[model samples]
Target: MRHLRSLLFVPGDRPERFAKAAASGADAIILDLEDSVVPARKADARKAVADWLASERDVPAIVRVNPLGSDQIDADIACLRRIAPDAIMLPKAEGAESIATLDSLLGDLDAPIIPIATETPAAIFELGSYRACADRLAGLSWGAEDLPAAIGAATSREEDGRYTAPYELVRSLTLFAAHAAAVPAIDTVFPAIRDESGLAAYVARAARDGFTAMLAIHPAQVAVINAGFTPGAGEIARAQAIIAAFADNPGAGALALDGKMIDRPHLIQAQHVLARAAASLLPSEGGAFSKAFNRSKPHTTSSR
Candidate 1:
């Protein structure tokens, strides 16, 4: 609902790329201090990210800090205290307990969080616990890169780069968790930047499967991700027609459209499509549009 269709990742240590990433048309930019920065460069990366955030205004950025139990987390928290980012991306999120702990730790700062919820074997068992901290989340997302290593697997994908069985399950659970929490479900990174065809197909599949947004490792993939998630003119027109049909006949429970029977279920979907379209037309810097779909009430179909 926040139109986070494309969230690009930039290394925190690469200060020169910060401005470039801001201009890349990505809905949000994540300054990654965890996996992207080596242990020796952690301090420097934190300083660079803090300096950039201090100088820049109107940049929609989030910081990917070290995992909850890592030693570097203290330093990350200190850095965040000095320079408040728009949001925080928590890596290797275990469950509600960790989230609660973080909530206590951040006491006054209390920035919105987006957790990479499926990176460890233990994380697979705690997907349901996210609902407890749903109110503080910007959205929910998962990662395939860390899971394979955690599970001692050679790869998490097939020869074609599609997720294998285990990781596929993780992806689905992440989707349901986000929806259950009434937040957006952002898909994991595609990893292969040069394969434009592969990236496009993967992103289309993600959009069709109810993923609200996607994480991009490179700037080149942002355009493709944005296009894949944004509703096309034909889809917008069809959704509008369905809404109009239902509005025109207030007493009717169902109606015919394009020679097919339209019902309550279809109407509900059309409304969602239109809502997403409207949100897309607005800015994507986590402003007023961020809470457009963060409703606690279910978006159920109306008979009228």
Candidate 2:
């Protein structure tokens, strides 16, 4: 899970902002080329991404390209070879065949793929196939804007500040699809950059609904998003207690601990909390407390 609690989206056309974005406290950054860039600025965006990939990108950079069969696909590939990013974001992926084509094209290249299970109605039906991408497939995310428009919806949001019924179906399905395929389910960006409290609420809702991460359109949202997903110090302490108690009784599936009946499921949940803490310890752009969750050094040999 690599503590990708907050994935920030930076417009590919803004080359000057790229480095600043990389330096932001976000765990990973996506350089967006699809919706964010204007049609006339496509070339300029592509050139900027190519240059950044080649030299300037400092963090775990993901370059998102146009759809699979689009005119700019080849150009996207060329930039990939030049810049060599941690992953590539594929838009409008309908099923396994599209991923297979990307895998075949990459052939032996090591860059992973992050698919946006969004856009058209057909994509929603075949979303589960994205998990077959495996190691080269980093995560699964969705976009409400395109999908809602494709389905002829007035807006993705409802009066209660929630996704409309159709979009909600897609959102939940994408989460299930990601889980079924054994990958991280990343929630889409919240468009309201100025609403910090609203952003936190949305991210909290997403986390509760099984999303491991959420995309941030602005750096100001990063702290709130990260905070929303991460287990606080108090939670970490509780998880640690459960783990220690479980370790003390290896053969016991259930035990009474601190007045609660802690069982195997509790232990499993505790381990997940600890694992998340460990990943948060990576060289993230955030502060020291960010690494406080990462207890990786004491036992480096053990897999996270």
Candidate 3:
């Protein structure tokens, strides 16, 4: 919720990488206990994650716990109760019911929940339910990897590694759902860790599509993701121009700017952009380590 432009995942079984992931400049580190950890290493991963939470964490951390109804869910909840992380990331969350169940289990822990909202076919229909538990939610993200497998598809992507039509629909729905629920829509990870150009294009498209944040599978992707999502000079200038036009033409329903009609909707859009850009300038709170300073490009929130 704190302008999470990039969240990096570290395998829960690999405690050696925990500190490294924290130092990678990501806004938050997700200790993954599900897909990243093998079946046999689950218990060990849980122990390692618990131990890390028990100790001092220099970065904000989220635990990607095992899916609902898994044998490991109980243990995951137990560890969470012992030491609640900043938030809990739920995989394969079908609907509000799973979230409600987690709420009941956690009782008064008060940890925010971020569900992978498009992992299953059932999850596609459950997007609307997020609004009911919006207050307990931190952010909403969707994955293209698991959904294809769950639905028995050959692949979730095209040969170019772009999302296929069906998975694209899932992505769009997740975006709308997150906005509808009044939470940040975090784009899924670009799994091709080595393909920096592909990752850059993907993140750029995500930011253009109104995604407030993105997930990163590797440290190398964090800086690019953060830069892509952060409001750039051109964007801030456009927002300021739009706001100034509206301010000058008080009580006018619409105004002309650069030969284009700027209406109430455009004014609102500009204000939102400025607001998010302003938020990006705030210092990290609660020892949340970030490599945002790595950005070489200048970003100005000062409206002219």
Candidate 4:
């Protein structure tokens, strides 16, 4: 579908919160069956999520199933077979092979996939391989929490909440890999839910670093994420001016706009800004997103 500026996660077991999350101003809601739910509750969560998805809903629903090869995955897939979500969020995804594997398990289900691409150590090296299965992807996102635990690190970030060097490397790799695969680069969740100022700064950095959207842990963070990703009045005005200047000189490679030299690259950037602005204005209902998912098919390619 269009770029999701914010995707709020709601625990699959907590069905009571599903409707609240759908109305939390987020572009979509991720029914988390992975990290959020306890092992004892996975089956119940799957049933709850299936029941919810089986009914009609206004917002798009993306179910975050347990990681591949886990005992819970078979049941997760079975639940999906009963009632398909708008998309599947595959956690601990390693690359094209991971996507291909999930696609096989999904069978005829036509939901799109969004992989959390950098959760394991081996996944770091597999980032570039996503290009092989980009057509099956909705976007690519990275997580810092699991990586640090996987590597036995004390923490993934510094005292200031900035990511350490290794985590930074993975983050940048995930960003470039998404672009290389021609998919949206989705930033990871900001864990400090109460730190609104910090969240704003993180969102600003994500937008500046070319992230099309961000994950949200709390409903309070949705509005901030949406506002951060949407173009401001000044930004929209500049983008419009750039487009007008390019239009005025159809065959020119470069032109002066408001006393500054603007080139083809500038025009392309302006177009992207306008596109994001327009996407932000679209209705949050699931009609458009469901149609987009139905139209999507797994890209046929040999597993890596």
Candidate 5:
């Protein structure tokens, strides 16, 4: 799949909102069958998700199946076998073993996997193992909510909504792990849905810290996430200028660019910026998020 800037989550049991989520201008939609769905409704949710995936979709559809070792995962896999989604999001993923196990269960079904890499304490220690199964991964993401509860912490964040010391460490580890695996690093969700300013700042920080995409709990955050990840006009121009400077100095190890010294590393960074700029344009060119900002109807569903 193309580099997704925003992946919105919709409850699997709430089939009524599936269409809305598809039209929410998000790069992809995640049909959540894990913590979002109650245990009693697991079967019903599975059936509902299967029915939806049976049809065609413009936006990429990813199903967040129940974690490994759970009874629900077997049924979830059975449902996926009937109609596979574009990708699968594995929750509470421990390591390469988890990805390998899920791949074996998938058999002939060939959807890419995006694992929530940090949920349990054991998962933290296993981050380095993801490089082993990197080929099977779409991206690597982490969860703050589940990890805090799993470790018996009072909260993952402070009063300002910033992640505490322990949570920050895990977040940084997840970022490095994703890079080590040679895949895109996806940032976790910002749960405070109504705080638009906070969401924007968080998105900017995620982009600054090298996260290519972010998880969205609500449809409203899609626009902000998309804008934050996309390179600005000035950024694109600067990147182009840097590339041109390198081109002018063919064999030079270091060159002056607007009075500052730039080397091969700067050239590489400039190339990456241009690549991101190109990827950002894909969504608006007959992609799912083309008309995202045009819709005026506000979504009211609260994210869990």
Candidate 6:
């Protein structure tokens, strides 16, 4: 499934934010009805989200409903029926049971799934089985906040502002869960709104750890997230060189390229990088968008 490399989460209760989130340059927008919306405003948020989904728009809009056992599930389900989002973000997903329950509830509905893997105690142990019910599932992600609190952690971060070791374990587990399920491994949001550098560092860490995308809380975070996840010129060149150096080497099983090992796995990795670079190259928009006068950033594929 094609997904948003940068997904911006907008509070469903905020009508003004919902409208602007579409054009905020995120590949998708998550109209959040869970944590972002207060308990009293949930009904109002659901109504607003339902209305927004009916309207035609360029952005791939999704609704993040409350957890399965919540009192708001009925309202969330009703809102989903009306809105018909691209996918449903299931927060606090427990395991196969929870997914099976959702499937049973909405048996005939066609909406896809994107389950957040870290939420509660049960979620951590059941993560290995999370992808068992993946017929309609898109990917997996982890939350640093909920799981830590569920286990009675004081905070989710380290002194250097990185996720604590416990949180890192969850993140890796989420990545493996998606990979095992043959789906995208989405990274969680960077909460520091004003710390662009910190956000970039976090994105870089996630990308290096094999996450394909990230959640964004603000419009300002979108561009950096997109750029950070995308493979650049140096990456593409190195990938190409790796592929070239290994090709037609009949006598050698493993060869050295730039003093680094170039083997079967490395070749596979290189090709994957090139593939992502190719996929991200959208057709240059002109006319109404006016690409002629605007200076576009010279990208990885531009020279190619």
Best by TM-score, which number? Answer: 4
Alpha-carbon lDDT, every model: 0.84, 0.77, 0.84, 0.91, 0.85, 0.78
The residue pairs that clash in candidate 1, if any, are none
lDDT of model 3, residue 31: 94
Residue-level lDDT tens digits of model 2 in 1-304: 3578888889999999987787778888888888898888888998888887777434677778888888888877777777766777889977666677765665455566678877788888788665555444677888888887787778989876788787888899999988887778999989888988888899889877779888888888889998888877987899999999978988998999889898988888889888887887766542222222222221111111
Write one digit per residue (lDDT tens) for candidate 1, span 20-55.
888888988999999999999999999999998888
User: Per-residue lDDT for 1-304 in model 4, tens only?
Assistant: 4568999999999999999999999999999999999999999999899888888888889999999999999999999988878889999998989988898898998778899989999899899998888878888999999999998999999999999999999999999999998988999999999999999999999999999999999999999999999999999999999999888889999999888898999999999999999988888777445576454454635346
Q: Identify the superior model by lDDT, candidate 2 or candidate 5.
A: 5
Worst 10 residues of 1 by lDDT: 295-304
What ranking of all candidate models by lDDT puts the best one first?
4, 5, 1, 3, 6, 2
Per-residue lDDT of model 5, residues 88-133, tens digit only: 8999998887887887888877677899999999999989988777
Q: Which regions of candidate 1 deviate over 4 angstroms? A: 286-304
Q: Give the local distance difference test score of model 1.
A: 0.84
Badly placed stretches (over 4 Å) of model 3 are: 287-304
Q: Which candidate is the best by lDDT?
A: 4
Of 1 and 6, the candidate ranking higher by lDDT: 1
Extract clashing residue pairs from model 4.
none
Candidate 2 Cα misplacement greater than 4 A, ranges: 285-304
> Candidate order by TM-score, highest to lowest?
4, 1, 5, 3, 6, 2
What TM-score does model 4 achieve against the real structure?
0.96
Model 6 lDDT per residue over 1-304, tens place = 2334788899999988876888887877889999989999999999888887787777677689899988998889877776667777889987666777765665455566788878897788877775466555666778888887788999989888887888888888889988887777899989899999999998998889899999999999999998888899999999999888877675677899888777788888899898778756653211211111121211101100
Flag clash pairs in model 3: none
Residue 31 lDDT (model 6): 91
| lDDT of residue 171 for candidate 6 | 83
